[model samples]
Target chain A: MSTVKITEEQLQLVEKLGLVFEGPGLQPAAARVAALLVVSDTLELTFDDIREILNLSKSATSNAINLLLNVHRIEYITKPGDRKRYFRSNLARWKNVMKEKFMDLEKTNSVLKEVVDQRTPATKEFNQSLEEMVSLMRFMNQQIPRLFKEWEKSKS
Target chain B: MSTVKITEEQLQLVEKLGLVFEGPGLQPAAARVAALLVVSDTLELTFDDIREILNLSKSATSNAINLLLNVHRIEYITKPGDRKRYFRSNLARWKNVMKEKFMDLEKTNSVLKEVVDQRTPATKEFNQSLEEMVSLMRFMNQQIPRLFKEWEKSKS
Candidate 1:
């Protein structure tokens, strides 16, 4: 329902960003839909509006939107007195996404821990390196949340 | 030549981890070689040794090792009186890799800034949200290096 017109170049940028998202595990269509929604003028668009603008089939749009919703990438908002649901990029959830990415360091740390536990090599330098990697991940794990808190404080 | 023999289970884990690395950007062969090098007992394996153990073809192993080296994922160490070069996980370079990943947030912020500038929307909430995303990225950009330094201090 947003009346603001999006330019062709902007649409191309969205298309390119769609691929970037795809690198992070999003399906092609879902990435495109998310990109389109993020760049939308109102940052919220109806299903029909998105489908038309993206030139996607109804099923594709529905599937893409649903995938995004499931992943908390996009969320739906219902307007009072309007039966249609409008979807927008869940910008708030981006912090969560970033937090999840930072958590990957923890995953790598755990994997390394398991490897070291199993190996138990006598090489002091190798063990030191492994422990250092684990410690760095732990430190990052501790710090990432604090960074989020700092951002929250600054926002206020 | 590392004297410690790698077990079958360890090799299987390396195979699994290769797929994980491939998800990020590395090709399959390169990811496998990287994982194999990471899990090596001495953390340093020569090209021929890696190819023989991983059962990779000469060109395949060479290409994979070269790719990993180019990306700073692995590094070579030359032993005195040995013509063969030993390759190992570049733990020191991982900080660089992490810094690069953190810098991606800046790229996203810049893209979002450009989009907002071009849009110039009247919606206060949308603009505010975009600015907030940019600010969070800026905050992270500043904090990531400090976190790295903290790790270095902890190491010393």
Candidate 2:
């Protein structure tokens, strides 16, 4: 078993981020996964090493790791001669994630606009309000690609 | 009373966004506020107009409006003959709100990093992982100003 000890202070910090350590849901496990990723960014621990240190069952650990990966919050790297896959968080991929999230929000906003359009309002004012939100979100969505492009340029 | 008939589809859309039509938490209030902003943007509804439609007590609606204002999720405007404040969601302003949320996330990530740094046996791999998250968040934060500038330029 790995002898790495998690401190109370560390746990507190993790908890502040809405991560539960010993909670009744996937939240705690998720938080631990995030904490592990944060630590792993500065350490050289493999999956086995991390699982042992956290004292989590293999299945629980794997579930957490899988969730992070699906969100693009964590990534796996394979080292030659080491069959074990090493997991790490990519610090530069959030831009894409944010972009994706914004796009999804825009899509939802569009659907809402259609609903608003179909609803006849006794209040002309209320109808107008819904239309404006649709316009605003659409405008923002239209601007995203340009925003990302400029972001890419500055990074280069 | 503004007879704005919210369609079932529209209600579903709002619910999906976590806007509460019926709930015990601030969530419903928050959702009402958000919906109000959406309406105000297009309909130019005055504060009194919003209160009547949502069926919320004036003070309750006022408080919810204030919360949205503080978050930059909505803005209030005053017009001639309109002693009452008019509220609307500023689409352009949402970029700032999103930026602030990203900064908050970065702060949380940093705190997590500090905790990992103080943990015993300080596995190099774990530390590396934390650093990676911090770096990723940092990069994302850094990209914001440039992205906004580009967005502004493109809009012109």
Candidate 3:
């Protein structure tokens, strides 16, 4: 009923990559589903295909798919005349992920600045270092846009 | 017996920061401990001070402290003639944390390259985009060292 064949090696890669996503707070099932989509041979996979391939429970598969879809980590399309939805990894938004990380750094810098402002002069050295840390973060946050531009320029 | 004091604002900041650290897989009590040391008035905190301030159980405080110490996220100092240990946030190692994150990006890129290599031609479009993602990652990985170097030069 299906043409998808996953090698043991591919299965191992899926778990390894899944752990990488899980490092950033993604749930285990959703992470595994995302990795499976990325490394699978088929361009797109239906819900049952994903569930069966990963040996996940029906609810687990549905929940994982929903979460991934909500986050835009994975996307789906419905084929002409087919009622089932096909899900696939959406690697195109990789730039947005990096930008969001940079934004988080900026937010952290502001928070630390407020912390620094609230500190006593007795913590002068630590405050100075923390300020420096914020400066460095600001510098890195600025670099992401430039880096993306460079990547884009090289592509064209 | 204690000179340290925490404001309502600082306490809120600690919880906010605990959530930030938790995003990267740090434990709750440990994250709170690390944030507490950063925003607290005192440079270093005793075990009892930490446990009381954060309202953590003895075992929770001990486990969190041990984990932060083991990871070098926090460090301890012992004053002469004092039997108690004084723990503080090791913000100086923040540079190393950023470096480790970049290293992680490099690791993920390599694993993704392997994914692209093993993928069938039917998924060519996704494969090429994945390759571009890897290339962009490699570029960013190279940028981190240069960013730090630029930062150091500016400092001196």
Candidate 4:
């Protein structure tokens, strides 16, 4: 049995950090699980460890775990000797998550451009604004790669 | 009565753009309303016009419009001699909405910093990654203003 005791401070940290993830579209329970994984001293927690620590019901924990795993936010590894699966936050993947979001914007921008194209020239002012918005999204998408490159350079 | 006839293409535009807004946390109905306001040739819609065109229930349309207004995604204008207020997309404010979203991260980061401070030194590797994530967010926040400035210069 893994010998990790849940701390009150750690539990509070889960709740605090949980709300942050929730705002970005994560389910509340899943966000809390994500927070627990990221901020815990152990860095990895078994299924029961998370459920007991967070006081989540079996189904809630199961659903939350599945959701996180499916989203690539959390990942699991099996122990060499035991059949138990240990779950850990894919903290390293956060930057990739943000990048994927911008990549998703390309499809949306394409549709926005299409909307702009089909609109009657009578709505010239509105079309100009929409065009500006699309250009801004494109500008930011272009900037993200450069920005991350800048971050990597500065970090080294 | 204003003479804005609903078209099939416009309905599809709403569905397409609605999904885009839904991704970033807007409710489906509200997202549809936002899409309609932005893409429609008229640039604005009356409450009844929106309700009829979208086939949304009275309450659904009302709730959707209210949500958009509360978020500053849409605004109302009154004609000089008419009492009926006209609803229009505040498309220009979309960039501001994205900016406010990042601005919200400042508060989230403060709590994250606290989590880092309270963690045991033993979790050095995990702590380092969390610190990096925090620094990245801070870097992006700092970069956004300069990025926007560069966009303005390029636009002109």
Candidate 5:
């Protein structure tokens, strides 16, 4: 067992991020688990350790952690010589989440573009507006990978 | 009054986007209103016109429209010789929405960096993880305006 203590401010930040994570379709408990993991002293915690700190029931903790793991937002590894599993935030996978979102945006943009293309030239103004949106989304998709590359360069 | 018709597919898209808008702090009615405006043939509709199409109560329409207007997600224009106001989606302002979200992400990154700094050197691995998130968000903030500019050029 690790001697980690969470401060009041840390707990408050965790609750706030818990809500932020909840915005992306995570359940309330799962979001809280993600938040707690992010704010934990070592940024990695065992199942029993998290449950004890969060005062969560075993079932609640299990369910929330499982959801997080399935989403690839969090991951676990077994410590050598120990039977316990340690979980931590999968920060590297956030780029994948951003890519997935932009892909969805691209899909929506294409659908909108198709809708615009089928319209008569008489609907010029509205078609132009829709076209602008498609252009914007396309620009974003083109640039996101470069942004990811920039981050990699910054780290090195 | 404009001769505008929404097709079944268009209406479905509007409904989907309405739910997406609802997730971003807009009330359900406001989100639906925003979605309808986006898919409208004229891209602009009068208050009475929208109320009729959406089958909303007068007060509900008023309340929802007011909320959207206050948030700068929608805007209205007055026609010459007309007392009636026409509302439309402020499509250009969506860039601002994306900017605001990135700013919030930057703030969260800063807070995490601060937390990482306070931890002991022994938590080097965890601090490095948090630093990478900060770097990624920082990179995004630097690139978003450039992306917006690229969209402008593409449109031209």
Candidate 6:
């Protein structure tokens, strides 16, 4: 296992970025989890290492890990000989993360579509605007996967 | 102004979608500000109205509004006779919002580049991964602007 000591400056920035873990709300526990993920690439820290360093309860750490996993921001792997799960940032393969985000955006557009569909005729103009927003979101979602595939091909 | 009452269920769903104002993470104040922008289209609301509805302090609300304005998510338009700054969401046009977000993503990729460049050779593999991440982000940034242009043309 690598012993990459995180500097104070890097730790501060990681915590600030953690504020973006879920969306706009900054939860300290979430931030701590995010910071660990950010440093994980270099540190190669196991779950035990992270728990000890952050002083987080096992369940709390598990929950944070789960959230990051849900977002495709981090991944867990087991070493060949070790049973302990090791977590690392998935930044190297961010295509999956972008794809997930675009899917969420598409879902939001669907919600807007429902709003537009349910509105009265008096607000037809507003409903048209919402429809346009949905179209824009959908268009982006369709294009992203293709773009990423092409990018990956080009890199290879 | 159309009085479209958002149901509690709808609000709860939006909150889960990271649309309604929660507080800062990946779903930044931008998503909430964007939500308010959409909601504003159906119901004319002042800055105070927005602040109250989102349960945000004046400064936080102002900062979010400023970001929305910068991103062209919301527009500042004055009434014919009123000097008060009236803000409205631009649901009909989202090309500008896509453009702004792409720009922000590019800026973040640049920062990531600096971090990767400054890292030690011992962590060279990790640094390479970071560079790949930066490349992917830059590609997305480049693709989005072109996609928006095509979208705008299609709409016209």
Candidate 1 local Cα displacement, residue B65, angstroms: 1.5
Could you give the C-alpha RMSD of every candidate to the true structure, in order shown? 3.0, 7.0, 1.5, 1.9, 3.1, 5.7
Q: Is the docking of candidate 4 incorrect, acceptable, medium or high quality?
A: medium
On a 0 to 1 TM-score scale, where does candidate 2 land against the true structure?
0.56
Model 5: pairs clashing at backbone N, Cα or C within 3 Å: none
lDDT digits (tens) for residues B1-156 of candidate 4: 446876898789889989988988899999999999877888778998898888899899999999999999999998898777799999778889867755776877787888888888998888999899889878887998888889989999
* Best first by lDDT, ranked: 4, 3, 1, 5, 6, 2
lDDT of 6 by residue, B1-156 (tens): 323345665455445545422322224555765665554334556677667666678898888888777756678777788765777777545655545645766655665665565565787677777778878888888888888889879999
Q: Which ten residues in a row have the lowest lDDT in candidate 2 chain B?
A: B17-26
> Once model 3 is optimally superposed onto the true structure by TM-score, how far is the C-alpha of residue B89 displaced, in angstroms?
1.8
Model 2 ranges with Cα > 4 A deviation: A1-4, A16-156, B2-26, B40-42, B57-59, B78-83, B112-122
The digit string of per-residue lDDT tens for model 2 on A21-112 reads 22212357766766565543244456666677666788888888887778776788888997978777554575565566557656557556
Give the C-alpha miss distance for residue A78 in model 6, angstroms.
Answer: 4.6
Per-residue lDDT of model 5, residues B60-152, tens digit only: 999999999998989999999999899998877876876675566666666666666656577777678677666776778788878788777
Across A1-156, the per-residue lDDT of candidate 6 in tens digits comes to 335466666666565455444342325775677656654335466766667667788888778778777766677788898888878877655656656655666666676666565555676677677777778888988988889899989999
What is the DockQ of the complex in model 3?
A: 0.75
Assess candidate 1 and give its lDDT. 0.81
Best by DockQ: 4
* Candidate 5 segments whose C-alpha is farther than 4 A from its true place: A1-4, A79-84, A118-120, B1-5, B80-83
A17, model 3: CA deviation in Å? 1.6
- Tens-place lDDT per residue, model 2, B4-106, is 4544554455454434222212357666667555533244566666677666797888888787777666777888885867677665565555465446656
**lDDT (0-100) at residue B150 of candidate 6?**
91
Candidate number that wins on TM-score, 2 or 3:
3
lDDT digits (tens) for residues A53-90 of candidate 5: 77789999999999899989899989789998999988
Could you tell me which residue pairs clash in candidate 3? Answer: none
- Candidate 4 vs candidate 6, lDDT winner: 4
